[model samples]
Target: MLQSTTGIERLVLVPSLLRSLLMYLQLQKRKDALACLKLWVCSGETLVVSLAKEFYNYFPENEYKLCNFYGSTEIMGDVTYHVITGMDQLRHQDKVPIGLPIDNTIIYILDSNYRPVKTGEIGELFAAGQNVAAGYVNGRDPEKFVENSLAIDPMFAKLYRTGDFAKLEKGTIFYEGRTDSQIKIRGHRVDLAEIEKAVTSIDGIGKAIVLCYQPGEINQALLAFVLTETNITEHQIEEALRQKLTSYMVPQVIILDSIPLLVNGKIDRQSLLKAYGNVNNNDISFQNGIDYKGVPKDQMHAAIALFETIASVLGKAARSTISIDANFYNIGGNSLNSIFTITALSDRGYHINISDFITAKDLGHILSKLSNDRKNAYLSGQTEHDYTSELLKDEYKEDVLDMITTSFYEKADLEQWLMPNIYVEDYRELIDAIWEPLVDKRLSLVVRAKNGEIHGVALNFDARDEPEVEIKSQLNIVFEFLESIEGPVRDNILPPGKGTVLHSFMMATRSTLTPGENVSIMNFMEDEVLKLAIERQFAGIFTTNTSPLTQQLGSDVYAYETIHDCQVNLYVASDNTKPFAKAPDSQRAKVQWKPV
Candidate 1:
């Protein structure tokens, strides 16, 4: 209808609409339709320099002009205008300038205090002119339309706070981004537009949009969606961003074949956020979004269960979709949350050791290690010895303390790092400090022989509710190292609140028993601990294994998963020295968990 009308010399549209129309015309070979238009006015959104070049290529710079109009409805449509007469205007520009004020409109780039910022300094764009709306309906948001503090004329007395940020350079205003787009991330004030610019500048990325998910929350994340022209992986984009942006400013990149757009041609940001939430949160509608490509037919059931469980635990905080090739850490799984994933998987009748999950290169690697069979055939006939596991009683307290002290001081691999600096008295003081709570919680277990001799002890506490004890001994170094590894896991990943996790703090066995006998006794004690967790309605058992024997049993024999492993010698104390420097490189402290 518009093409048939006479004297149609000018066209006005949003930048998105113009781009869409131009693409359609090029696709249909209908460049003649644009011939009637002498000029095109693009507004509402920032005009890409590339898009402007494309326009002139089709319409011919000699015949038509492209003008960028910048304004909002509250400012009576447009307050500033910039015209591009040829490709030369866009050659050296990073962004198309919003240009100078139109007619009687006055534009001011002001700081937070409403004072004019120096030229070239980015600030909020405030406008004062006859074009500015008097006020909103019912005086809503009266503060947005304030008195023009620097105005000397009646026409410029009222300034409309555009809420947009821009900078004036050499008599021209350049659009920056919305004021709300600037946010604090990990103590750094980040500009989302700046990140977006950096992303789009990378080769093969056609366009990019960056958005923050769950802003200001503990699990808050910045996500980047890129429309790419090549087979670029998300990891590659993230790595590129790390080089150009600050570490915290780097976002989880999600590559798209095509950027989703609304009917009016604007980027569908809400839809993008919703789709991300659905996939990450394990919403039933999007469960198929998980890729099971590398999974075997036999493991399909386990894969589905594991992937869905991981999604449920990670929820919207997950940075990427659950996929067979996705690394747990890259997809938002951490040591603490790995326990939550293990527990969730266990609930579904599938189990894997935390070590196996942690060490697995990808979800497919984890799937190969996943076991649906809960029966421990190897351990079936091993319990022939006459050892019974029971709760620790005050009668056995002195024996338990002695056993713990002797085992840790003489045989513990982790303490070997500190060796002579650590004392037997240190273990006694530590045992004394935790003795009260261990007795009260009733979670600790002890293995006793038929002759009433206590052979093993497993000190347990509620993971979320463990009491804070102050240690004056050098043993505090070990405790600090433990906290450095365990604190983040507990606070960030595990289910919040108490009663969900039973922390198997310290486990020790008497040196009197042979290695095989020690394994059997520890196995029995672990089973009893699992039973106790079930009886107490706790979700799982959390523990760290510094001894090779316990670490082996936790993963190979008792089915506890290893979530994280830290090299003993890598531990640096507050004194800025490697306290465990003498420890072998192979010696590691493995954080393990067993789901009830």
Candidate 2:
């Protein structure tokens, strides 16, 4: 074996030694046994992360790689293995996607009843390839690997199942855990890897291993063994995790060490748990009205209650025990819901940046390495580097005022501002589409144009996630953008300023705004079209802030509440590079045209 910095390399060097051994062995005349070096398994969610590390470390620095093996096990012996880069980005996140479909491979994931769930939903992965193994050995459970009805149509060939759970997002199949590894908590099957992922996301801990600990006595609680640096303290470790993990997924005990694996190369779950007793056993509680009570939790069950509360938020089964520092994120609280948790905490008189959980939740071990305080904090979340080039306080009070003033579009000539440039036929079509719907309602969009051309457009409707056409898909972004641009208008949409719940599945916009003209157009939309939607009884309005119609109106006519990215399936360019536009289409971008 050769020595190395990253880890041991070339554990089996079969060259010069084989030359000498040739003298003793009869098989020396023959080369080594023929073995196909094809990728046998693409690491699935059922596969542990340690296996990935092993494969990576086993090969030479530039030689090791991730390959995609395609085709069903029934047809062929794992027909294809396509290698690719960009796996480093996903190494610490979810499953690594090797790439697209390979030659002669039909990979599909199916449900228990063997029906396709959806285009991108999670299912049991099955392969159909030329070299897949014909069948399993020695009375193996047939149903687990067999499909009676031959799923892929037209081909009609019987396919063997891989039994791996996976989901497709944006056309990329992502592996989930095996159904066997999945644990049901409160009617939801939980992926244990997801919990482990959250635990590892905590900074300062080098390695984290979670074990299902049930001593055949009390309820099941997770036991986490962490490998970290020497300076980490127990207290800091507990707190660091609190930011990222919810309650139930947190381990009952955390054992810290410099190394996590045993000599046999397997995780030493037993050794870590044995060492956990020595660390500080004091429980930290967030009891109401107690104000940082230093008293131990042995006398009070408040900490356990809080733990249960956090677990409920994460939808985890009520665990028997949990560590105080467990991060909420790793336990299935995504960035979106983590923000909700922060809101909940804020209402309880504590403001926390979920990022602080990185260091603060380090079980007192890694908290010392933190450069900044990871406690009660309030932030707008939009990074300074993201927009204004600096992270600010919870509110950007001064700049917000200036932004509002600059964003205003005053349109004293309302009708001319409504429709800037449009042909009469198209304007009439748009009018007919809205005018009929409004006949049953109170108000309607009155279309107008210079020569009967449609200048701009506006509409109103009750919110819903139905009908996959038009602008319903962008309802979230449009609403958030409107809220950020106009608060009073947003409030006007919500009856009694409360209890109006909504998610948009439809919305549409036809715009000529170039990338350079986007900001200007936003000001106009906030000032004009959106205002018209609210005046006409829209619960929320969505239109660019700088449309010709909006520019005609002044800034004071708009007020917003919040604005953020609406994550969706689309190829949104990283750079705001405007698509090429013909001259006729380019004129539509000018802020002077009004919508009829």
Candidate 3:
């Protein structure tokens, strides 16, 4: 038997090790597991910020210092250490900082130019110390082991550039993201690791991976695959991200049973992309639908229909097993499946939205909400505007102006925009200024309820004729932005001659109706506008806005183009299967036209 005379006070382990010890205690086999330890040091993956509190919560008799060590495999385990105290220290935070550098190790947070970045600014982490590995065996990439001329003697031979994004604050080193983990989505540089950190900060998310799936030439999708411990709605996750990140930074979050890992314990990114495509055939499937098979038969008719719609979208295998209560996420549903399901249901005369499907708890809840919304928001009246005549009539002008004012005022409130004192007449004047130019354009429409109250309005006009200088400048910037992004769809998106912009759209029922109903209104409005654009062969249908919801709700099955900072998104109508089918057959043909 092995024996040691040393009484262990400090315990160094990975998070998995500590979890295993806790599991043993839960089984009642080892109530005093690791009771002799005074300090428990954790390394390897980011230590859960609340691990210290959790340990005490489960085993009140045991008390120990829980330290989270941070470093990479190339740096021989740890470079910094942070001793955690309580959950209060981590409230609203992602993870504990790696803390100050260990003895004999020096860490530098530097920008891309290799200059020291300001404290609290995210930058690549570089290590200069005796503990840093002496370069990879067999001569690997030299970029990682480059020598820094500014380094002092003992550590002069090499300065390891760890690719890890981090920031230093008050002598503590906090991990931010990874340099290699950045992705360019719709011309915006997105850091996937940042998303993962944000997701893990949420209460119930066990782990998360932000993955980019580039299926082919044009379709690039960013999806968040997460391991959640408790039931959470997608909207809740989205709302949390909305508070911490820009709208463009929020990726679609998909809950999973577990994160797929490689044999060596690192994330299997390829597997995640594969599962994203074939969501039905993954390890995350709803317990193979065994629980679903046992559901009661007397569920509501709407619930049955919703379940069938989900099952049909998931494919043939799911039709028999997916119960009325089965979650779309657990039963092989994904974003792609969701789009198809909603489209199919719409064809079946059941209007719904992707947001509605993802936010609901289950089929029963969604059906109940859907039933209620339809009864309350039923379309009672309609006045389709004929652009050939006066588009904005005197009778409808007040209600239209009211819708615009209310919507814009709400936006102003949310953004905290300080504007000059403005009344209803001021709003009416601006609306009139934009409305006069649409004298003969068939691109404006309004829908009203039976009470002769306007419930919806869609306004589109030639930006070239806009009277306001601010509006013209914005449209000019949007045109330039679209022309800048090079892709097969660029030609189709570039303003042909004069740009036709859909500047304003809002449903009065937006405040009262469910997301599904609002989406229905949006879809109707977009369809009407797109038909007008197609009939006229207008340059491009675009909207200038900062909100991502505008594009998400409007660009259904359409080829979408966006210029990130400008908040200009152009939606071009085409076959969903081949969004850029109208583009030139070959790049050579376009370059051939250019004068050399």
Candidate 4:
């Protein structure tokens, strides 16, 4: 019926409703009805780039223009306008600009002191113009309407504070957010709109809304509701945010199929919060939401217990679904909360090390690591096999070399920086150079399966008696990097003796083993090494862990004391190049030791 209407040259609608209409028109094959619509004015909320791109795709003729109108009721409707003639304007923008003020309307970006902010600085928006409304009828919030401090003309005598933050660059005004959106998190002030902008800027995110749940209380948490068009998980979004924002600024991301909206087209934030509260308020309803399709009957009891513990900890902050395939981090588990989950599980007689839990690909893998008997059976796959740690042997050299080459090239974190510059020959050469000393030290250990295949290797050396070998390959870069972080601790922190400190130089597991299996084997090797250290009357065992799995085991599971920690990305080599420059700030090399 609306398709027959005439004289529809312009349309003013909220961005959200416009998006729904555009999608509907395209789906209904009614694009021709919009031929008379020459302009679309979007206001009431920020128009994200994703929505703008949708509009651009729907109307490619360039005959129609999209304008962003910015204003409040006190400003007598829109006081600023910007027109998008083509997609080029949105290519580099996160949000559509509110643009220059309308004729006879004056806009000022001012700081808390009411002074004009410099160009590109964000401040509260204030407006003074002929269209400015007189004081409110009830005379409430009288401070909002005040005498214009910078007014020179009689028409600009009244100024209305918009209570919104914005910045101006080259005469174009960009909306920042509302001032009331700021809240304190862990003693640091965080802007929900800033977090929302970051989340929306991610490549596949269609929309995002960041809200604080239970503010000013002990259970307060910052939550981000994201609508994504891709298969990206909550963990991936949170990791991406960690790269762009500080640790405290990162919010727990919840992926959603659709966001609730009000009749006026704006997001219904209160409904979103209420829904979260409802999900957490009822335990039976929450438990029913978990997926248990793939869980084994034998492990069902333990899985349910673990799930309940996790639910108790995460509560309202969990992602949309919980299942055997879901990752702990992807389901609202952070490092701190992970510890809480672990402690809760321990109380219920379920046990798994932090490294195993942190590195598990999914909850099913974590469930396998909860018990030693089950872990060994799970790692061996079809048939259970007895694995044992044995001292270094001459006949196992070939198998050891193969494991080292594959593990270092494919899984080692530090070697990844050198990339194409590293080769299998480098590791072969490294093994050859150190082979003699490794055997003589009698400190190296390897884990062998029932089939006599070596799956894990740990090469150790006395802190003061280790032999020095000349390395001629790019693998030397890894050694140099290790020495730069490990040398100081050996020279100053550890005990000064050839037999007093056993330095764990290199440890690697087969490339085919799952992360949980790798941790199990490594744990066995570490235990055997400590026994050997105790037999030799050494004061302690010293090691440097670069991989995140080993780092967690050393610190959290094995109770090793950390002596020195170095950020891998911050290390500059002798060539003055940061080989690990692409590494995340959280990546580190930990020098740790456990006393005998």
Winner by lDDT: 4
Error of 3 at 139 (Å): 3.3
Indicate the worst ten consecutive residues by lDDT in candidate 1.
376-385
Q: After superposing candidate 2 on the true structure, give the runs of residues whose Cα lies further than 4 Å from its correct spot.
A: 1-82, 86-95, 98-105, 130-138, 148-156, 185-189, 215-217, 233-235, 256-596
Model 1 lDDT per residue over 300-367, tens place? 99899988888776666566668889887666654335656766787898877554565567898888
Which model, 3 or 4, shows the larger TM-score? 4
Candidate 2 lDDT by residue in tens digits, 295-351? 244523434343434444333212222344443333333322333333444444334
- How does each model score on lDDT? 0.78, 0.38, 0.56, 0.80
TM-score leaderboard ranking: 1, 4, 3, 2
TM-score of 2: 0.35
Clashing pairs counted in every model:
4, 105, 0, 0
**Decreasing lDDT order of the candidates:** 4, 1, 3, 2
Q: Is candidate 1 or candidate 2 better by lDDT?
A: 1
By the TM-score metric, which is better: model 2 or model 3?
3
Candidate 2 clashes: the total is 105
Better of 2 and 4 by lDDT: 4
Any idea what lDDT model 4 has?
A: 0.80
- For residues 427-463, could you state the per-residue lDDT of candidate 3 as single tens digits? 5655666665543454577765445555667776653
